[model samples]
Target: MQIINARLRHQAALHSLTMVDGRFTAIQAQSGPLAPQSGQYDAQGLLACAPFIEPHIHLDAALTAGEPNWNQSGTLFEGIERWAERKPLLSEADIRRRVHETLELLIGQGVQHVRTHADISDPSLVGLKTLCALRDELKEKIHLQVVAFPQEGLLSYEGGLALMEEAIEVGADVIGGIPHFEYTRELGVASMQQVIALAVKHDKLVDVHCDETDDGQSRFLEVLAYETLKAGLGPRVTASHTTAMHSYDNAYCSKLFRLLKRADLNFIACPTESIHLQGRFDSYPKRRGVTRVKELDKAGLNVCLGQDSIFDPWYSLGNGKLLRTLDFGLHICQMMGHQDFSRALDFITDHSARTLQIADYGIAVGNPGNLILLDGEDDYSVLRRQGDVRLSVRQGQIIAQRPAAPLLTPPWLSA
Candidate 1:
């Protein structure tokens, strides 16, 4: 398969890429018009880049907004309470349908790599088992990494630790915990310790929901980072939704940044949901419930963006597009400078690939034939217009395509 007249990042000249046996075999500049050949895909000078990665999302809770009752308060706690009401009604078929539909939405948007959290606090472990099964079933089309997430609390909830262990035993690829959501600060600290220990024991990666609150004192991020550093997990550890850092004093954050850098931690900021679910208790001079993304990037720390929720109890909106998240994140993080905009796409692409530890990602020789052609010339154009994905190719095969929306103009206007 050949992709002709595609614009790759950091390359001015149009290039053609070849894929053989599901691996990129060649990439060369298109010198001039050449004889048309069979098995060729004409990109028409569209921006061709690696597929988007969703590093943090809740698959089990996706598309479940207002299942039993609406979260009128619009708070994270309210969403959790509503989810509790809906949990008992879950069935394998119900979860499978919703998750598969969500994945389809993501895939249509050119997202091929996803790291989803499966709520493992259920006594039945239904979410974990279901997601694990889907991970195997969808291996060909998507890379699904399942995190055994204890959504409730690892120590506060009954038999929570046991369920978390069982989830890892039953094919979970990553270990997850909600430290701030624990009953107390001590339990939160313990939860982080337990999650890291479990991950080290099982040789799995750790992604904790750390400090996802607006309280200036939600200090679980420091504890999680300390645990990651102590365990020597380093890059294998991710701290998702460190929104509390938005409220931390400069003095403390200045000190915390050093620890985070030493720990070599990866961070995920879910702009859409965090902005929606956080700062609910604030009145005048309300705060933005997002992490310090621009600062993190400037500090040489890896930070990525995530959609976080799509019609879930926590956030009642989304269409599975990371670009939408990027747009919101860029505005919220004040990352509108020229250099920042040039590298803004990395928040959803390369940075996320690193967080997920996708070894063979991106468009290069010998890498998997996974790339998306966006309907734009550059990242700014694509992002500003929220461009459509012209084609989504996975393993040398086109998996999805969206036709450009036609514009109609009067004859006088056209002339």
Candidate 2:
């Protein structure tokens, strides 16, 4: 198969890809008078780039907003309480339907990689079971990585170890923890240690909700970095939503960056959730409940963006669209320059694949033939207009294609 006149992500000139047997065999310049091949796709100079990746999302509590009641208080605690109420009402069929629906929406937007954190704190373990099954169900179009996430805490919550072990034994790809939610700081450290040990034991990855708060005193990130570095596991560790880092003094953060860079840990920040759920307790200068994304990027550390919720208890607004995630990420992170906007797309694309550790994922000569063509000339145009995905190719086949939506026309308002 030959794909012609596709805009390159790394250059201005148009290029073509030769795909054979579900992999790109060659990428060369489109400077030929040769006749069109039998199996060829003319992109018409559209934007062609790597498939999008969703590095951090909660598939268990997705699309469950206002099940019993809404998060009226607008606090993380209230959201957790509301989710607990809805936990008992979960059934395999119910969870499967919503998750699959969300995945469809993601695929339409050109996302093919997702790392969803499913709750394992429930004694019934219904969420973990449902997501693990969904992993197998959605592998054809999307790569789903399920994390055995203890939403409450490992040490504070009862039967947490057993639940995590069960999740790992039943095919969890990662282990997750929330240290800030623990009852005490000491317990939080213990929980991080437990999660790291579990990851080592099961040979899985670690993605913890580390210090997701406004309190500057939280120091769980240091612990995670130290452990990951000591164990010689650098990129295998991910710290999601280190919001407290936003409040840290430069002195502390400067020191922290040393450990983070040495360990080469990945950072995943949710801009939508951070802007909404944080700063509720402050009065004068409300802090954004987000991490230092630009700083991390400048430090040469891997940083990715995420849509933490999609019409869920924690956040009421989400479309599961990675473009929206990138929009908020650029706005909240204050990365609005020309180069900033161009690289901001990586927050959901290349940088995210690194966070999830997706192998051979990009528009390369020898990479898999999983790519998307959107309606734009460059990353800036595609992101500013939120262009439609013209084509979605998976494994050397066109799985989905969408045309440009028609502009509304009336007799009086016709253009």
Candidate 3:
């Protein structure tokens, strides 16, 4: 199949792409007759980018807003309590229904790769079992990665460590823990060590919910960095929601950055949830509750953005759109400069693929022909307007395409 009049990111001229047998065969600036074969597409000068990747999300609690009750205080702990009250009621049937719906929604939004944290602390393990089945069911449309996350606490929750081990054996792709939720700081650090050891023993990946509070004293990220260095597990480990770093003083953060770089750890920030769940304690000049995205990117570290919640107990908003997620991140993180727009978009696309360790991503020849066509002229326009993904192709097959909504130019407004 030949696709014509497509704009490759970072390149000015319109180009044509050729796909053969589920792989990109040719990519060059359109300079020839630009002939089309029997099954061809004309992008109409729209921006063409690699398929989007979601580095972190919680599939278990998705679309469960107000299940038992709403989060009145809009606090992180309240949300956790709500989820705890609701976990026992969870069944494979409900999880299957909601998860499948959510996956379809994401696929339509051009997300072809996703890493979702499914809570493994459930005594019944129904959520874990449901997600594993969904992962296999959605294998062709989207790549689903599951993390056996102990949301309650690794040490505080009864038999948490054992359940996590069983989850990994039962086909969870990653090992995850919520160390900050433990009973003590010592327990938190110890839990991270256990999480890393489990990852190494099972030969899986590690992504911990580390230091998600606004307390500057929260220094578990340093502990995770140390563990990463000691275990020689560099980029395989990710620290999600290090919101506490926003409050860390320059001296301490500088030292932390040095260690994080040496350890080569990845970071994922959920900007929407960070701002909503954090900063509740401050009276004035409250913090933004996000991580050091700019500093991390400048240091050549792999940083990505995630839609941490979606109509769930924690957050009551989000529509499975990566463009909006990136925009929210750029706004709160104050990364709106012209030079930062392209880089911010990469937080969900190229940068996220790196964090998810997707080896076969990108638009280069010989790579799988998975890409999206947007209603955008170029990268800047796409980022500025939060352009919609009009067409999504996976493995050289067109999977989703939505026509542009009608322009509602009312007479009064236009006049």
Q: Which stretches of candidate 2 lie over 4 Å from their true place?
A: 32-38, 407-415
lDDT of each residue in 1-415, candidate 3, tens digit only: 7789898888878899889999999998876435556678988888899998888899899999898999999999999998988897899999988888888889899999999999987877888888888889878888989999999898899999889878987899989988888999999999998998888898999999999998899899999999999999998999999999999999998899999999999999999999989999998998999999989988989999999888999999989999988888989988879899755568889888888889989999999989999778766788777767999999899999988878899999997
| lDDT by residue (tens digit), candidate 2, 147-205 | 98999888888888888888898999999999888899999988888888888887899
Q: Where is the poorest 10-residue window by lDDT in model 3?
A: 30-39
**Error in Å for residue 142 of model 3:** 0.4
Give the candidates in order of TM-score, highest first: 1, 3, 2
lDDT of 3: 0.89
Question: lDDT of candidate 1?
Answer: 0.91
Root-mean-square deviation of Cα positions for candidate 2 versus the true structure, in angstroms:
1.8
Among these predictions, the greatest lDDT belongs to 1
The TM-score measured for candidate 2 stands at: 0.96
lDDT by residue (1-415, candidate 1, tens digit) is 8988899887788899999999999999888634557878778888999999999999899989989898898899999999999999898999999999999999999999999999888999998899999999999999999999888899999999989888888999999999888999999999999989998899999899999999989999999999989999999999999999999999999999999999999999999898878888989788988999988888999999998888988889999989999999999988887777776789999999999999999999999999999878888878888977879999999999988888889899987
Any idea how many clashes model 2 has? 0
Report the lDDT of model 3 for residue 246. 96
Model 3, residue 145: distance off in Å is 0.5
lDDT measured at residue 228 in model 3 versus the true structure, 0 to 100:
94
**After aligning candidate 3 to the native by TM-score, how far in Å is the CA of 252 from where it should be?**
0.5
